[model samples]
Target: MDEEYDVIVLGTGLKECILSGLLSVDGLKVLHMDRNDYYGGESTSLSLVQLWKRFRSNDKPPELLGSSREYNVDMIPKFMMANGTLVRVLIRTGVTKYLNFKAVDGSFVYNNGKIYKVPATDVEALKSTLMGLFEKRRARKFFIYVQDYEDDDPKSHEGLDLNKVTTRDVISKYGLEDNTVDFIGHALALHRDDSYLDEPAIYTVKRMKLYAESLARFQGGSPYIYPLYGLGELPQGFARLSAVYGGTYMLNKPECKVEFDTDGKAYGVTSEGETAKCKKVVCDPSYLPDKVKKVGRVARAICIMSHPIPNTNDSHSVQIILPQKQLGRRSDMYVFCCSYAHNVAPKGKYIAFVSTEAETDHPETELKPGIDLLGPVDETFFDIYDRYEPANHDEHDNCFISTSYDPTTHFESTVQDVISMYKKITGKELDLSVDLSAASAAGEDA
Candidate 1:
């Protein structure tokens, strides 16, 4: 207990585990502790019984819903982009070897009271019903331009400077309709709202390119993938990586308190009347609430069903993005569904989630637009959780806290938060460059 470590990570959440792994891989001694006796903190996956216990209290689930052990429902559901930063991190850290991934079956967008697949290629764009005949031609041309665009290739710039223009400007140049712009910005680019339209076009261009590349990687219906068992495998895989590199882990520790120096710098963590010294501390916002501020709240509904989401090409797993404009809301709503094919549920069962940034106090009513899309749910659980971010700088107090998870059912923003915290803690940007092709192959083999 008297030994000092370079860092003490105070939660077993995905972000904390990944940071612990990265720091340990960098030859820093890390002491990872979680008050709960589990690898995942807020992001843990629960069995049917656990889910029932948390949401339904003493009531037991009906037998028609299937066996309790057969269900692995994620508390914070998200899918990985096939070629995104998180996948790169997994491959780079050799954590992919510990997990198996299956490509998601569909990626659809909601517009004009209907859902349609998001076209990732020029061929699909030409066939898409989301646009008119002339609009399809314009969109195809725009898709081709994006596909051929290279940051260093002046000829590929199409006489437009993405860095100097807004996404709205670029979309208008192609004469795309407002509906076309909605899907392009929110679905294909994975933006949560229309705010990105006013941002630099370069960012959206890169996102579109990434989406296209990811779709091309798997040649699947969607650009995302999920683990076979659920997202619960992620934190544990990273924890194993951290352990292999000499990081220590302590689960079920009670009252894991952050000890601070008189100058307000975090120096260690105390638990069970024992103090383990460390030069710095990293943790989720829950571990040190005073250092964080609530930014918003997320409303979510977890549903168990016997069939795939209606009108999603009968996909066993899918991600549907309902743009804010279509829903007449301030933020986008997401529908993520995974079935027995992904090993998250029983043979004939599917787990679907409807989530969004909370705009009203009634989560069930707020998520009605998304929930209504599901054909029929055997059971549903509604919840709302507050979102938070660190209010203090790590440079001042050596206490780096991760922000609460957002409602977006993708890893892009989550990984950005991890990378941001990694830079703050280590004073270096995380090198995420990896052979994505090779990693995709490995995932396929898995």
Candidate 2:
């Protein structure tokens, strides 16, 4: 284990795995290690029995939930936007060949005590019940403006400059009401809060375009996609990519301590009394606790249900966003659901999660608004975990620690962090446009 490498990644989380694979593909020698035997550190998917063990004290799961092996419950639940950054990375690295994907069934937004489908196209905008007749016309025009606005085409600009204008200014031009603005900003744009309304309109506009484009990917009602089994397959897919590039992996390594040089820069990792040296180290927040600080907390409710969410058209999988304005909160709340159709649960059963930034001490109460939308949950588990970010990044210390996962049920931030960290570590931008066929050499799925 004394061998030296260019980079030694210390976690099997999706971000670390993607980086290791990208670096390996770039012809850098890499070594990946995880304290746990399985992939996905904080973002793992567990079986029904494992879920019982973690939250229910391992008192054998109820038989009514079906066999434990039939379930693949995600610890940190999120969906991949069909045309989003993660999908681009997956395709670029040829990780798609190792996995199959299914389009999500629906995407809804919580309004004034009701739920409404997010308008994806100009036609849907005009037909939406989310706005009044006059407001619908206004929204339809805005949708058209967004759909037609191209980055390189000046004619599409229509006398407006997204780079210099504010999103709030653009919405006001259309005479859009507060409710229309709510779904547009929080739902379609997928903003974490209303703060984006004050930022440059370009960011929000691009997000809206991405959402619309993703919705058009499968035309299956929503803009998101999930793997056939669950997100657990994602890390493994990237791990395979790394392996094909001659990267080595070690799992179930205990008390893997980062060894630093006399000058404070990380030099290697010591595990089981054997030290493997490396020029740089990348890891999740859990490894270097002192370098990260708690920023906030996430409260979530994991539920098992026999039926789809009440008002979602009986969709097998869906994402329902609760805007901060409608919910009177500082941040938008998210409700993510998937069923056996996605191979995440037993037949006829669904896994639904209601998650948001922790505003109160009680998770059961904090997530009540989103939980109420679920008709009757066969089983429910409430949990709250701290969110952290790097507090001390020693440029001299070659440790590139990742921030804790946020409460968002999307991969936008996750993929962005991976890309940014890749640049900082390798001093080169990760070219998502670069196609790598080397990773597709093994796809003999049974």
Using lDDT as the measure, the top candidate is 1
User: Which tens-of-lDDT digit does each residue in 55-148 have in candidate 1?
Assistant: 9999999999888988999999999989899999999899988999999999999999899999977999999998889989999999999999
- Residue-level lDDT tens digits of model 2 in 250-353: 99999889999899899999999999999999999899998889999999999999999998999999999999888888888999999999999989999999
Candidate 1 lDDT:
0.93
Off by over 4 Å in 2: 434-446
TM-score quality measure for candidate 2: 0.97
The residue-level lDDT of candidate 2 at 295 comes to 96
lDDT for each candidate structure: 0.93, 0.89
User: For each candidate, what TM-score against the reference?
Assistant: 0.99, 0.97
How big is the positional error of residue 176 in model 2, measured in Å on the Cα after superposition? 0.4
Clashing pairs in 2: none
